[model samples]
Target: MTAHFVDLLDDLRRRSLRMAQLVEEVVREACEAVFQADVEKAKRVVQRDNDVDAEEVEVESEVIRLLALYQPVGSDLRLLCTVLKVNNDLERIADCAVNVAERARHVDARTLAGPYEDLRQMGPIVVHMLHNAVKAYGSQVVDDAQRVLLEEDAVDALYGQIIRRLVAEASASPAKIAAFLDVLSVAKNLERIADHATNIAEDVVFVCTGEIVRHRMH
Candidate 1:
C-alpha cells in the first residue's frame, strides 16, 4: 500500500472507533433509562439510533471503496475487513440499545426489583464487555480482545438466570406476565449486545494474529 492509502486507512479506523464510542454511550444511556426509569433518556437512545445507522452505511462504503481502489493485501486487507465487520457490529449494538430503551419506556423499575435483579447485574457487564471490545479494536491487541471474550460467559450465565427466574415468576403471577415479558425483552437485547461485542473482539484477535478464533469454544 502507498503512503496515501495507509493514511486513509488510519482515518477510516479512527472513524470506526468514534462510532464505537457513540454506540457505547447509547448503551449506557439505555441502561440508565431502564434502571432509573428515565423516559427522556430512553428517547435519546432511540433518536441516536438513526445517527448510528447512517454512520454504518458510510463506514461500509469507505471500506468497499478502499478495497476497490487500493487492492490492499495482507495486514491492510485484514484491517479493512476488521473495520467493516466491527462497523456492522457496532450498528447492531446500537439497535440493541434502542430495543432496550423501547422496553424501558414500559418496564416498571419497581416491578423489576425482585426477579429481574439478574438483568440489572447483566447490564453493567454487557457495557463493560462492549467497552473492552472497542478498546481491543482500537489497540489491535490480542490480550484485550481475549479479555472481552472471557466476559461473554458471565453475561450468558446471568441471562440464563434471568430467564429461569422470569419463567417461575410468570407461572406464579400470570397477571404480571406483561411486565415479565418486558423484563425478558430487556434481558434478551442486553444478551444480544454482548454477543455483538464478542464478535468485535473476535475480529480484533483476527487482525492482530491473522488467526480466526471465532467459532471454537472459549
Candidate 2:
C-alpha cells in the first residue's frame, strides 16, 4: 500500500510538471506572436487551447482516481487537493494566453507606433512567475512560491506604466484608438496571467505548510 501510494503521488507530480510546461509554452508563444506580429503563432496559440483543456480534464480524472483508490489522509490529501487547485490555475493561464493571442491578431501592426514595449516588459515577468510557481510545486519549496507571490507587484507596476502610455497615445491620435485598445487588452491579459500564477504559488504554500493563504479564513 505504501509503495502504491508513493507511486500515485509521483504520477500526480509528473502530470503537474507536464501541465506547467504546456502553460509556459502557451504564454511564451502568445507573447512571441504579439511582439513579433506573427499571425501564424497567434493562430497556433488559439488552436492549442483545446489541447490544454484536454490535459486539464485528464489530470482531474487522475486526481479523482487517486483520491478514490487511496483515500489519502493528512499530507496525501493535501497534495491531491493542491494538485486540483493548481490545475485550475494552469488552465486559466492558458485561457489568458489565448486571449492575448486573439488581441494580437486584431492589432494593426502598421498603426502601432512602437508603443507595445510595455507589453513586452510585462511578458517576461509573468513567464518567470509561472515558471517559478511550477518549480515551487514540483520541489515543494516555500521560498520559490513566495518569490512568485512577491513578483506580482512588479507586473502590476509594469501594467500601470502601460496604461499611462496608452492614455497618452490615445490623446495624441484618436485614429489609433482601436490599435491602442488592443494593446491595452493584451497587457491586461498578461497581468491576469500573473494573478493566476500567484494563486498557484499560494496553493503551493498550502500544500507545503498546510495553511490556506488564499483569503482571510476567519
Candidate 3:
C-alpha cells in the first residue's frame, strides 16, 4: 500500500474509534435513562443516534473505497474488513441504546423494582462488554476480545432471568402487562447489544489471529 493509502486507513480507523466512543456514551446515557428514569438523558441518547447513523455510512464508504482502490491483502484487508463489521455493529448498538431509551420514556423505574432489577445488573455488564470489545478493536488484542467473549454468557443468563420473572409477574398481574413489556423491551435491547459486542470481539480475534471463530464455541 502507498503511504497515502496507509495514512488514509489510519485516519479511518481513528474515526471509527471515535464513533465507538460516541456510541459508548450513548449506551451509558441510555442505561442511566432507563435505570434512573431520566427522560432528558433518554432524549440525548435518541438525538445522538443520528450522529452514529451518519458516521456508520461514512466509515463504510471509506472502507469500500480503500478496498477498491488499493486492493489490500492479508492484514490490511483483515483490518478493513474488521472496521466495516465493527462499524455496522456500532451503529446497531446505538440503535439498541435508542430502543432502551424509548422504553425508559414510558416505564416508571420505581414500579419495576423487583423484576427489573436484573436489567439493572445486565446494563453494566453489557456496557463493560462493549467497552472491552472496542478496546480490543483499537488495540487489536486477542486477549481483550476474548475477555469480552467471556462476559456474553453472563448477560445472556441475566436476560433469561429477566424474561422468566417478567413472564411470571405478567401472569399474576395482567393489568400491568404494558409495564412488563416495557421491561422486556429494555432487556431484549441490552441482550442484543451484548450480542453485537460479541460480534466485535469475534472480528477482533479474526483480525489478530486470522481465525474464523464465529460459529465455534469459545
Tens digits of per-residue lDDT for model 1 on 89-175?
A: 999999999999988779888976765778889999999999999999889989999999999999999999989988897899999
Candidate 1: lDDT over CA atoms?
0.92
**Which 10-residue window in model 3 sums to the lowest lDDT?**
111-120
Which candidate wins on lDDT?
1
Ranking 1 against 2 by lDDT, winner: 1
If the candidates were sorted by their lDDT against the true structure, best first, what order would they fall in?
1, 3, 2
How high is the CA lDDT of each candidate model? 0.92, 0.86, 0.92
Candidate 2: list runs displaced more than 4 Å: 109-113, 215-218
RMSD of each: 0.9, 2.4, 0.9
Compute the lDDT of residue 101 as modeled in candidate 2. 83
lDDT of 2 by residue, 1-218 (tens): 89988987998789888888888899999988877778999999988888989999999999999989888999889999989888988899999999888876787655443556666778888899888988888888898889888899899999999899889979999997888888888889999999898888898889889998876321
> Of the pair 2 and 3, which is ahead by TM-score?
3
lDDT of model 3 at residue 94? 99
Deviation in angstroms for 98 in model 2?
Answer: 0.9
Clash pairs, candidate 1, are: none
TM-score of 3: 0.98
